[model samples]
Target: MAFVALSEAEKVYIVHGVQEDLRMDGRGCEDYRCVEVETDVVSNTSGSARVKLGHTDILVGVKAEMGTPKLEKPNEGYLEFFVDCSANAAPEFEGRGGDDLGTEIANTLYRIFNNKSSIDLKSLCINPREHCWILYVDVLLLECGGNLFDAISIAVKAALFNTRIPRVRVLEDEEGLKDIELSDDPYDCIQLSVENVPCIVTLCKIGYRHVVDATLQEEACSLASLLVSVTSKGVVTCMRKAGKGSLDPESIFEMMEVRLVLGRCLDLAGSAGCLLPPWSHCGNSPH
Candidate 1:
C-alpha cells in the first residue's frame, strides 16, 4: 500500500466520521468502494481476470495442466494457489521480500477452497487415479490501495468464473494404456459455476466503530481489521484478522454484521450475468 501522510486532525476527522457510521467517500459502514471487473483480458492465459477495488488492483490467471491426482483424493482434481507480490505494487516487494506475504495470501486461499462445495473438483478428473486437470491460479498484485485481501478475492472469483477447462476424451486400449485427446473445437469447454465462490470483505476498526472498504490512509490509522469471506448465498466460509493490533469480541461480531450485508451486494454485483458490459457488443473490440 502506498504511504500517504495524514495530519493528526485529518486522522481525528476520519475517526469521528467512522464512529458516526459514515466515511469520507460518502459511503455507509457496509458499503464497498467501486469495483471494476474485466475478464479474459490476458490472451496468453487460459483464463484471466482483473479487478480494481477502490485503488487496489489485482489480476489472476489460471492454467490447466494434466497431472496425477493426489493420493488423498484420487477421484478429485485440485487447485494450486500462487500469489506474487510484484514490484509494480510496491518497491518493498521487489524480490524475495514479498515472498512471505505472497505465501500467506496463497495459503489463505487454499484454506478457503478446502471444502468440496466451493468447486467441483471431480469434474476435473480424467482417469480418477491416472490423470486430472490441475488448475494453477496465479494472482499477481498490481497495486495495493488498502483492502488487498478483498481485491484479490474478487479477482480470484472473477478469474475462476472466466476459466474454461478444455474438453478432453480418454481412450483405453487392450493393454490398458490411456490416451488423452483434446477437443477439436476450442469453444467446446466447461465453465465453472462461480455461484459458490466467495468474496472477502475486510472491516477496519477505527475509534469505537468499524468501516468497510477502507482506503490505504484509513487502514494506516486502524488498529485491527477483520477479513471475512462470504459466498453469494450469505454463507461465511472463512474469517481472519490481519493487523498488528487485537480486536475485541464485540467489535468482531459487529464487523460480521456489516460483512454479511456488504457480501450480498458484492455477490450480486460481481456475478457473471451482472458483469456483461452493457455497451459492449459481442464481437466489438476497442481499436
Candidate 2:
C-alpha cells in the first residue's frame, strides 16, 4: 500500500465520516469505487488484463509454459503467482524497496488459490507424471490508491478467464519415446473454468465501523483490516487479519458477515454485470 501522511485533524475528520456511514467520496461504508477491467491487453502473453480501481491500477498476465509435473501432483498442473511493484507506481518502491510487499501479496494470492475448488488443475496435465502446463500469473502494480489485494485478485481472475492454453497431445513411438504435439489451429485451445474462482475483499476497521475499498487517506485512519476470499456462491475460502492492530471478537464476526455480502456482490458484478467494458463483453467473460 502506498503511504499518505495525514494530520491529527485530518484523521479525526475521516474517522468521524466513517462513523456516520458517509465517506469523503460520498460512498457508503461497503460501497466500492468505480472499477474498470480490460482483457487481452498484452498480445504476447497467453492472457492478460488490466484493472483500475479508483487510483489503484493493476495489470495481470498469465503465460502457460510446458514443465514436468510435480511428484505429489503428477496428474495435475499448478498455478504460480508473482507480484511486481513497479517504481513507476511509487518512487518509494524503487530498487528493492518493494520486494517485501510484492512477496507478501504473492503469498496471499497463493493461499487464496490453494484449494481444489478454485480451478480445474487436472485439465492442464499433458501427460501423467511427464508433462503439464504451468500457468505463471504475473501481476504488475501500475499505481496504488488503496485496497491492493482486492484489485489484484479481480485482475487475476479476469486474466485467467481470458487465458487460452494451446491444446497438446502426447504420442509414443514403438521405442516408447514420447513426443508432444501442439494443435495446428491457433484457435483450437483450452480455456480454464473460472466459475469457482474467488475474489478478495479487504475490510478496514475505522473508528467503530469498517469500510471497504478505503482510499489512501481513509486507510491512514484505519487501525486493523481483514482480508476475506469468497467465491461466487458466497463461500469463504480463506480469511486473514492484517495490519498491526488488534480486533475484538465481536468486530471480527461483524466483519465476516459484511465480507459475505460484499464478496457476493463483487462476484455478481464481475460475472453478470458491467465489470468489463461494454465493447469487451463477450462469451469469454467470467460467468
Tell me, by lDDT, which candidate is best. 2
**Per-residue CA lDDT of candidate 1, range 98-117, in tens?**
89889889988998899988
- Give TM per candidate: 0.91, 0.94
The Cα local distance difference test for each model comes to: 0.81, 0.86
Question: Candidate 1: where is the Cα deviation over 4 Å?
Answer: 1-5, 273-287
What lDDT is reached at residue 111 by model 1?
A: 81
| CA lDDT, candidate 2, residue 161 | 88
Tell me model 1's lDDT, rounded to 2 decimals.
0.81
Off by over 4 Å in 2: 269-287
